[model samples]
Target: MSPVPDHGEESYIGSDRLKGRKALITGGDSGIGRAAAIAYAREGADVVISYLPEEQSDADQVLEYIKKSGVKGLEFGRPP
Candidate 1:
């Protein structure tokens, strides 16, 4: 089996540097949360997103982007 890449070889995503961390992103279905999702992935942190139930379309798009970031995307919401 192929070996997984190590953290040492990863590039820094932002000036803030959030390596080896996990973030629970609120309002993550769109806007800032969407942006943060990708940024956090590049920064080497796992991300989970939460948003309102009515925004499923937007949320789906955000989740798609998050997936492209190579991280997991979780959705949490109520019926709208």
Candidate 2:
């Protein structure tokens, strides 16, 4: 099993550089994709993440962090 890694869970800080922006990221349930999702959310962009259905657990975590940024967070997953 791949360990669920921390994607800047406590290290990233934002300054609204990307306020009012929107971003769509594929494979965003983990790894670099998860990191990017967190970064975009912190920067003030509403984020949408797409991932395989089996990755829902990881995706949920990302969504939690994204929403904490006070921006909208959306997720799309494929049917297994």
Best by lDDT: 2
Q: How far is candidate 1 from the true structure (C-alpha RMSD, Å)?
A: 10.1
Name the candidate that leads on TM-score: 2
Tens-digit lDDT track of model 1 for 1-80: 25742222134345336666788888876666667666776665667778888887877776666566566666676464
lDDT of each: 0.65, 0.92
Deviating ranges (above 4 Å) for candidate 2: 1-6, 78-80
In the range 1-80, model 2's lDDT, one tens digit per residue, is 46856688789998999999999999889889999999999999999999999898989989999999999999989564
**In candidate 2, residue 5 scores what lDDT?**
63
Report the alpha-carbon TM-score of model 1 versus the true structure: 0.64
User: How many clashes show up in model 2?
Assistant: 0
